[model samples]
Target: MGQDETVSNTALEPAVPQAEASRRRLTIEVVIVLGLSLGQSAVYSILRIIERMTRNVPLSQQTSTLNQSATPDRPWLDLTYQLVNIIFPLFAVLLVLYLLQLTHPRPWRMIGFDLRRPGFDAWFGLVIAAAIGVPGLGLYLGARALGFNTQVQAAALADNWWTVPVLILAAAENAILEEVIMIGYLYTRLRQLSWRWPMIILGSALIRGSYHLYQGFGGFVGNLIMGAVFGLVYLRWKRVAPLVVAHTLLDVVSFVGYTLVAPHVSWL
Candidate 1:
């Protein structure tokens, strides 16, 4: 019995160092990701926000330009640039996933990527999108009315077979990158660092809002509210897939709807 006990203790010992190494690897990966990829945006956003504040420029007068030509001088270059715009965020998502897999052998599953729950996620996403969409549109209009936000042009692409598809893909990429990296990876890493749930949520939400500062104070405020609500929803449901869907839905409406109606509607 003593010999058997000795054997069991010896067998268990290897796992201790293995677990410690795993943890160390994760910490390193987290640091690298924050500096290089998705997490880097918030830092830049914060600096820009400071600059905007200092400038005291009228946000109502300023145009928050997006979807500018990738290469105005050369159509070939522009096409390539356009493609790369969508690819960039997708690559960031992939990079962090690779980093996550270093420690989390099943990172996707850990972050609520459940293939089995597709129907549920879709239903939940539509519900959340509906909940967010009406108020979100109202928020934008109200902000613009109050001279707080710039009148945003959702789609600037010229007509082509690929234009709508490219816009749709861009929206999807935004959803994936923001939801996966911001909520899934950031929150999980923070939680592992022994942060409390509220702090983690707030931190994540603030970062989300921060990166949208280019849209002016209204953007900061609206997205800040969105961040908090989305963060809480992610915490409660633990399904990133739904958040992604909802986000995509929101952007699609914004981009496509704006393109179609901006010409006919004077207020927009």
Candidate 2:
């Protein structure tokens, strides 16, 4: 080969190993971050499903409750616990944002978490919510009827003055944590490591499903589909803001709506 070509090849030699090392490092980072957050929840959720399956009663006869009061008898202590539960998990979201900020000057805006286009985000969020929520409710009912799912109680907190507010905060927390980490952070990291769109979407969906397994098969299936849809939406718009908004809306409706309506509806 010519001298110039030989030198060019030698100059590029270090890049290959460097790139591979970077990929390895990113892989490890992804594992650790996930382990410290939703990945941990996914493990417990799997165990929860196993425990439910081994019970004497059918899955549909069992219950999976969220937002339960830590101290049901003491309103003040329960409120404290509720706030703690909603606030603490969000540290993971901050951690991911910090990590992203190291590489991105405007990490929040990069992931579509900012309010640059509030109207667009809101419009799309409502559309996505309607698209997912209605069918999701039907899916839940069908799954329960078919004995593939446990009865899911989205809220079990006492009817204190703070109940609705706390539920709203919890819903927002869920949206921020899940969409930020699962789609915004996870998808970005995977794409950086040269993952294909399909693989990234599927992996995120599976993890989402795994974490929701505590609610039973129906929860898993419902969330898996939700994850895929959200992943695609993120891919399409390069934004997670709408996803956060939609998820918050869905959970708010589930938690607060259930707390208000479940008492009057026998089937709920």
Candidate 3:
């Protein structure tokens, strides 16, 4: 063969094996990251839902509480515990960023986790928060009325001077962790693997919904829808920051607003 033909054959020979290896590596990476983080949550959530289903009480009468106090009798120690709980889960996010940097030169910007477009992120986030939050509340209420959902106490932390700030911090943490890992990282990796958009969005939505199964069927379905919506938004804008903002706002209202309203109202 001529030199050009020899070089061409050499270059082409390993293409299939290289592509297969790349896909395998990305797949393993995704599985490992998820196993350590939300995938773990998803497993426990599945178990919790099964447990709730087996209980003697109706699902509607049962409750799933969030932001509970770790040490109710000791406020200062409880505060310490709360902060620790809120702060530690984010290590998973750091792990993701580190892994992404191995392949992408600017991983934060690639994932849209930076503050490059504050105004667009903020306004779009508010719009999404309202769109999801109002209907999500309605779905929860309706599901409860029909005895298909649990009474979710969005916030049950004791009234400490630090309660609101802790809740807000928790909200932000959840937003950043979920958006970056779920939409930003997973979507990017899956697209690299040549998966179609429909499958990517659906898979992400399923995982999102699965982790919320502890709350009941309503929570699962509602979050499934939310995940699909958020996934679509990420595809359209190519930005996870807006989704993070929207998630943070939605969670803040659910967490802090519940504490403020639960005491004064008969229905919550």
**C-alpha TM-score for every candidate:** 0.84, 0.93, 0.93
Tell me model 3's lDDT, rounded to 2 decimals. 0.93
Q: After superposing candidate 3 on the true structure, give the runs of residues whose Cα lies further than 4 Å from its correct spot.
A: 1-16
In order, what lDDT does every prediction score?
0.78, 0.94, 0.93
Tens-place lDDT digits, model 1, residues 156-181: 87666666777788788888988888
For residues 184-230, what per-residue lDDT tens digits would candidate 3 score against the true structure? 89998889989999999999999999999999999999999999999
Clashing pairs in 1: none
Q: Which 10 successive residues of model 2 have the least lDDT summed?
A: 6-15
TM-score for candidate 1: 0.84
User: Which model is ahead, 2 or 3, in terms of lDDT?
Assistant: 2
- Report the poorest 10 consecutive residues by lDDT, candidate 1: 3-12
Candidate 2 residue runs with Cα over 4 Å from true position: 1-16
Clashes of each: 0, 0, 0
Query: Higher lDDT: candidate 1 or 2?
Result: 2
Candidate 2's displacement at residue 34, Å, is 0.6
Of 1 and 2, which scores higher on TM-score? 2
Q: Is candidate 1 or candidate 3 better by TM-score?
A: 3
